[model samples]
Target chain A: MSEKIDRRMLLKATAAVLGAMPLAGCDLASQDPTVRGILDSAEELTEAAQRTLLSRQSLAREFPETAISKHFRANGSDNPDDGDYQRLARSGFADWRLDVGGLVDHPLRLSLTDLRAMPSRTQITRHDCVEGWSCIGKWTGVPLGGVLQQAGLKANARYIVFYCADTFGDSLDLPNKYYESIDLVDAFHPQTILAYDMNGKPLEVPYGAPLRVRVERQLGYKMAKYVMRIEAVESFGHIGGGRGSFWADRGYEWYAGI
Target chain B: MVRATHWIGVVCVTILLLSGLQIFNAHPALYLGMDSDFAHPAASIGVAQRGERKIGVTTVFGRSFDTTGLLGVSGRNDAAERAFPAWATLPGYQDLATGRRWHFFFAWLLVLDGLAYLVFSLASGHVWRDLIPPARQLRRIGASVLDHLRLRFPRGEEARSYNVLQRLSYLAVIFVIAPLLVLTGLTMSPALDAVFPFVAPLLGGRQTARTIHFICAFLLLGFALVHVAMVLLSGVWNNMRSMITGWYRIKPEGSLHVGEN
Candidate 1:
């Protein structure tokens, strides 16, 4: 293993030194138009490489019981602080309903009991935040694929957009309401779930109570918290800022597999 | 070829550093353990305001230091606190998404460029002949370090060949730091975690990998600074020309090169 690592390092160093060779002679490649074009297309190239390495169904690592962190620090909007969310939380989320609408054959509204009664899965997985932190917890909820199957996604549907109750930047406006989206490839992944339980108990408000979508393969931000609805859409063109998610709309990469 | 690669490295590394700092500011804390808490961090750096003044604070293992103006406090009159100023970051704003895009895009270029450099250097025997110090230089490596410290540099034929310190530093950056940075970076991704599960434990966990990544980046930066200083002191025109046109005007013997220790 050590020898292999050494060989790899040698190759990389050699390549980096060799990589510089073209710059001395190729003025055309250095041109702004050509460089911009390469940068634009590089995203797809990287995405393809990652997907090719791991199958879509590949499972994220699951930790042992003892590995769970004592304190999984709350990030972004820990609490909605809105009247509707507060009311639902006070009433044990009995009145809360998950509106599954948009480009689906059957638009269903599911209560927490209905979701719990459905076939479920529980797995201990790590939540990797883009901000460079991680936490492990056991999540229990129904698979998002199962729910989507029940709702019967329309043939044209290209994305699964999760609408959440949490609002950002001191506004309850539509644009501020936190929303995230995932394509069908991720939507149907076996590990993807709408979790209601955390670490053998009900999820606390700070950790997205009632329910949240867990796209385990992506970063924590992709796991839309405080989810109130799931919408199957052909495209996210009309979504806030025409970007797939709230953070994506701001400046984050919509495909945050890293 | 060498000059082109060196300059590309310069631009990419600059983008990586500024954008990376911005990304670090988002959380502004690092931990060594398997798990972490807000109440205590192994190390934390952030900004706060006190009575019309903004302060950048860095706390390491419970000890705090005031970083202030340089970090945590923006130069703008509004006094809004940000960990790193906008100018240093890629988009010149507190946008992680854009910062990441810039970081990743340039990261690929750097790696690809590295690969090309490696293949070419090996084929040309540049690695063994030029980069690796000759066996005789090994015995006199101590003198090389002392000379560097004393601000003395080689001239004439000696100047054309890299000294022991130059060879070692360049080799370390190429063979150690760059690869480690890429591997540690991959370790942080959940998708890659699925593919290479052993990386986490091997590197002591994702957080540890992140800390190491930061450390490696700073080391690279330090190398760059020293490299530029060496270039300027040695002979900026000659050095720049050597990299650009691949023609170095070697000083004649007994030219009396100035030494700055």
Candidate 2:
């Protein structure tokens, strides 16, 4: 019996080892530079296909009017402790200005009043959170594309970066700072806007009053609250993590298409 | 001891099947702190709060939770959630949390049991002998791959404990499916990324992980179905008794014999 068991064990060990070796080999194959390059190219092509394959106007799920929680938790910094932001808040954010520059034919530094006076688009959309909470609200804001067109995006500008007043840096990640960006396509999405009023009232300080982002296609982290500056760049190579956001640097996927 | 071990494995698998379904369903198991203004069907409290204030389909959570203008997608409010029936849609938070806890608990049980079995089998030499296929198996394996996959067990003592197909399937389930489930679940937890920042990037993204998890679950479900069918078709009472009492009572041609594990 022992001899028979020994024979069986030997055969089993050989088979098991042989069975697993190929998978490890496959892993090695994947790590090969040429293979890696091919895969990366496939991923890029897939992203491009995904862009034009589906209409950006697809509607997401909307919950009942009653599902709105009484208090939506303010996720990040409620107020900027920065002196400039504090002064603007003290003056009711009337003097806050949104500077649009970088790779733009026309750089514009417009006051909050000027932004508010521009033609606006209102949308009732759901906010999918990284923490998994979601809420729907009526947002009234100027279209982001109009602002970009007004500033006149430079021919080489491929993406727009939003720099906020309140720095939610180091809170979500070890040392990564909080910032967000969007490509030219999302910058022109119909639902995309520079919001000023939330629900039905003038935006409050905690809500990025005077101006904030309203990119309606991705998860919550891409929304850079607090209006201050917008920069358009061709590449994110020098940024926190090439993905163009602080959370992206901390392993959050930049294209949170959820 | 082998018969006893088989019986124990059977019992554990059965318990796992039942509890796993309950946890996945999450309905009718009213634990505290599980009230949704809108719960999933598998959840009584997930879709709607215990005392829901409204039944309308257009529930709007306030502006704060709205990803729009508040940490939204690509700076656009990512309003994208998978479509669900008006009555069935739920808050992604509540559903994910409770579903996760239940899923995690069962997952731990599966992992622990699987690990313990591995250790036991290794110590007992069962892994080397009983679980592995032979070299001659490759020779018999070549011509009719499809027939083997249909699981046409040859017959009698020549039947062997398991065939090449079974060996491949079991190995894949243990190595591939189990790890996929674990990694995908980890990818979804935002906090998990803080300590193990490699998860989402490794899996591509949170949504990508979710898609992979679903695929893995389907694979496991397929394995379970084939396993149950094979057991039932072979000899229900014999298989059941072998797992329950450890020694299979083989009665052939009016003679009774007990097979050694």
Candidate 3:
């Protein structure tokens, strides 16, 4: 009996050490630049594979009204703490203007009322988060392509960058303003819209009240909320952290198709 | 081809499992519908304060269990409050982004390696001649199972080829469980859903697909454990040699088998 117990203990100890070795090895490997670069390449491979498999005009699945989630979960910044954002929210966004500039042939600043007058499309779609949760919500918005067309994107413009009002970071002292960017292929996709309403109601502050981009084909983080500016750029190398998006800067995949 | 793909698969599966656990730590919950109905999660792991002490609680289909030290919460002095112990996850820390990076890289490698193995197996007639049991073997499945329960593995000439139980299990792992894992994994990707709109719904829903993926991962882990035990019990050096060098030492006929009748 004692010998059996000894053997069991030895087995347990061996198993524990064997299990712990991988974790230690992986942590050390991840710190190596070459290892990280190899891992990062998978993101590009996934993007290329997905783009090849999907048509440029392929639309995400649209669901019926019954499919809408009962309580849509709001993530990231619920409300921008910036004073300008607060004041605009106080006045029901009457003074809020979406600046469209950068590589655009026609720089334009439009108010909420002007955007409301534009042709709108409403669709119910699933919002898949990077954290493995999903929510279905009905979004009503103007096609982002139409807005970009109105702004007259310059010949050099290759990417659309969305600058948001909300600031996000672990520390409030050095807040990183939320931002995201997408290539022209995704930017001009028919289903890509700047949503002003959700679930048949005027969008609430919790859900990016004034406006949020709805990139239906990508993960939730790609759909930047509290969109304050839409800039057409040749490249996003000069953007915050030089990664094109806030989350991407923090190691999340920029494409986010998966 | 088998030996090369087997080792590659071993490495890929190890990384995939550990990194997958890290990703699961981000939400630490599972659901079974079109979306995550947060109010009614099918299973979830969380930390709760009980007086001055914090306890790790794991809930499954509304039933709760205290799974501290091993799950829900674990670390040196129970400092970490994440689902799955730090030791079980890649990086040994909470970094979903890095975890995802490792997972995707290995996932692609695994798929590529699996494809190579499939092609080789088909071309070499390995699947038909080895993995598929004949009708006679199928009829004696009950007796084969009884033999396994008794730890009475085939010996001498009988051991030259895979036994019925081994063939059936290998077939199930390769043709059924492995394909399900891949299909369910692809179903969870929102981008794939856009192109193949019917995939997720056909499997019930994205959340259901996620659940199935998790279940399949555990099933694969279970198979690996049993496989290793069988390898050790039947003849560790011989089995390892066969897998490593495609040469297995078979005991001569009528030799007394150790630890068996």
DockQ of each: 0.33, 0.02, 0.49
Can you write out model 3's per-residue Cα lDDT over A1-258, one digit (the tens) per residue? 997787568556755755755567789887788999999999999999999999999989999999999988999999889898999999999999999999988898998888889999999999999999999999999999999999899899999999999988864433399999999999899999999999988889989979999999999999999999999999998888888999988889999998
Off by over 4 Å in 1: A1-42, A170-174, B48-54, B74-80, B255-261
Score chain A of model 2 by TM-score against the reference chain A: 0.77
Task: Output the lDDT of residue B14, model 1.
Answer: 76
User: Which order, best to worst by TM-score?
Assistant: 3, 1, 2
The better candidate by TM-score, 2 or 3, is 3
Docking class of 3: acceptable
The sequence of per-residue lDDT tens digits that candidate 1 reaches over residues A1-258 is 997787568557756765753422222332345654555455676678788998888888888999888888778889898889999999999999999999999999999999999999999988988887888889999999999999999899999999999887654444888899999989999999999999999989999998988888888999988999999999998997688998877656677778
lDDT of 1 by residue, B110-150 (tens): 88888888888888898999889888998998898899988
In model 1 chain A, where is the ten-residue run with the lowest total lDDT? A22-31
DockQ of 3: 0.49
iRMS (Å) per candidate: 6.2, 14.9, 2.8
Q: List the residue pairs that clash in candidate 3.
A: none
Per-residue error (Å), model 2, residue A160: 0.7
Model 2, C-alpha of B194: deviation from truth (Å): 29
How would you order the candidates by DockQ, starting with the best?
3, 1, 2
Name the TM-score of candidate 1: 0.87
Residue A180's lDDT within candidate 2 is 87
Clashes of 3: 0
